[model samples]
Target: MAQLALDDYPDRYHLSNELHARPFPELTAPCRAAHLAIKQPRDAADRDRGRDFAHLVALLDRHGAPRPAPGANHYSGPLGRGFLKWEMHTEFVTYTIFADGVSQRPFSGEVFSLFPADWLAEAPGLVVTSCLVRVEVAGPDLEDRLGREVLSWFVPESLAVSQVVDAEAVVAADFRIDENGHCRVAVFARPGIGARRLGRIVQRMLEIETYKSMALLTLPTSRGVAQAVARLDGELSGVVAAMAEGGGQENKTLDQLLRMSAEIAQLSTASAFRFGAAGAYEAIVTQRIEVLREERIGGRQLLGEFMTRRFDPAMRTCRSARERLEELSSRAERAANLLRTRVDVENQAQNTEVLRQMSARAAMQLRLQETVEGLSVVAIGYYAVSLGTYLLGPVVEPVGIDKAHLSGLLVLPTLLGVWLMVRRVRARLDHGATH
Candidate 1:
């Protein structure tokens, strides 16, 4: 028997392996991590991505780390005292550097020094989010030391501390920028926990911070749009009020409405991508927090609670701004439609008046036509009677009848006959026209 032929899809393998593209690093406890997220300008969707690749190559070259494959979106390898993982996202790139051991001092601002100053200075984009995370072994008196030493690292009021991943690790962060312009996160993991578990914990914490900051980037845009929309609302209200007052200026009102609608459309178009991105990033932050399944540590507020109190209101504001924009757009469209309807109605009224005038003129013309027809009938009858009188004058005299008397008798009948004939002819023409 012949073997059956098979067809292969070109991207089958590549697509299937996409989920594993960025596997969580294997991290033992007692490690220091620094995460940096860099982004280009908002309007630079088509900016030169090669700059990111070039910068990554420079860093790799300095540390003699293995070069990433060409056209790769992510890479992970060793760099001197740490292993660096770099991932290029749609709007930004993140580099996570992790060293195997913590410094002698906790949260001393030394962990982030792993990045070469010269290399960072030459970065291609601006830093949007930077975090210093320190993972250490949990000591016997971890709870007691937290208030005295750990809690002091962050603002006491705003600090969020929790035990996550079934109490595999305790995480603490204040979500504040220090003097060095970096956020700090601390994780204390049980010594017996597997390295992969620790890695996952650290990854989740860093992601929460990065995504949170990214989500807030749209706040300013939302505020600006809100102010612009408010002005348009007032203008639109004035236009609608004018229309209600029955101003004979429908054309002007329509023009104003069209301009308002166009401006709203432009605003929506400009902010569509940013708004959508913000929503997506916010969702990711929530998902990351949920997966952590945090429990309170020593009656302290959990990270989720902190986000609810501090971060959720900002997201709500962004949402409200978007809703307001949509509402204004809808109102503008409705107003324009109303104005068009009013214009159409006014035109109809004018047309009705014109038709009434035309009807009056038609009635006058019919009356004049009737008078002209009567005169024509009379003239024709007179001519007919004269002709009859001349032809029958001799015959009438033989019968003892005067020609004048005969002509007078024939005039009445002639007039009646002519009138009837004219009426019949006109009637036939009218009937034909109707058909």
Candidate 2:
């Protein structure tokens, strides 16, 4: 059989590989996992990503493990007896360690000691969140009461306990930072629960903690943005009200409006990525809890209920702040447009008045010019008549006619001819100007 000749796209393999990357760790029960997420405080998404890769490589070297490919965003392999999973995200990077046995102290923060102190001091960024997950398989002692021992491990006030995956496991977490500065989550699974299902549950628990922490990072930003939005809103309202008066100084008012609009746009652009990223993380948090199909344990609250009471408001604040910024930006844009139109109309009115005044001045000047032309014709005609009478006095005497009467007859004819000639010249000049 002959295969058809075809050309592959430049990124076909890379794109296909992306779909299968970052697979969940396969783990059996009675295990311990330590998860760490690190992010830069400023411009994290634009920071030098090579430093992150270098840090991962350094860790692999310390453990005598193979390194991930250059430019790869994820890696999973053995780090001594424990396994390591590393992933890079848009603004942060995460590392998770899975070991075979649970700690005797049950999340006493020993897992974190796996990373050398000097190596952690060289981390590329600050710790956004770190968690200790302890997975235990149900035994004769815990078969009927998986939550009994965990309930005592966490603080009772903020604790959340749930049965997930059709009651195959019981998960409990107070979602509180312990003295060791790590969030603690516990999972107690049934004996018959497959390794894959337990792995999935453990993955969900880590994601919820990490993403929840990431989502709340926007709350402080939202508070600052809220204040700015309020001030801009007030200023915009005043500018719009001033525009309604429709008077002079439109250009100055418009300048003020434009400045306000520019500020609004700036605020929107500055906070856009953070707010959007937080919103996405919040959705992931919700989805993870939903897929767990969480059911309450005894009179205790479910994970979903705990999130609703404590976490939902912070996320909503992020959303509300973003919404307000967008609304304020739109309002400023509308006001600027209206002010510009008003300025145009005002300028047009002023121009129309100027044109009207110019037209009136032109009409008055034309009348004055016509009066001066009539006076010039009279003066020229009088002079011409006087000269004719003086020169022809003797010639007319022989015919019995007086010089005074001759001058009288010449007066009207001279004036009429001069006026007609002046009219003809003025008509020619006016025709030239019209063209």
Q: How does residue 270 of candidate 1 score in lDDT?
A: 85
Cα misplacement distance, residue 63 of candidate 1 (Å):
3.3
Off by over 4 Å in 2: 1-3, 143-148, 241-249, 386-403
What C-alpha lDDT does candidate 1 achieve relative to the native structure? Answer: 0.90
What pairs collide in candidate 2? none
**Cα deviation in Å at residue 41, candidate 2?**
0.6
CA displacement after TM-score superposition, residue 380 of candidate 2 (Å): 2.9
State the lDDT of candidate 2 residue by residue for 380-416, as single tens digits: 9999899989988888999988999999989999999
- Candidate 1, residues 1-435: lDDT per residue as tens digits? 985597667998799889999999889888889899998865545667889999999999987888988889899998887889999988889999998888887666675666789889988888999999988899999988788888778899999999999998999999999888889999999869998888998999999999999899989989998999999999999998998898789998898899899999999998888789889999999999999999987899999999999999998888888999999999999999999998999999999999999999999999999999999999999999999999989888988889889998899899999999999999999999999
Question: Once model 1 is optimally superposed onto the true structure by TM-score, how far is the C-alpha of residue 417 displaced, in angstroms?
Answer: 8.9
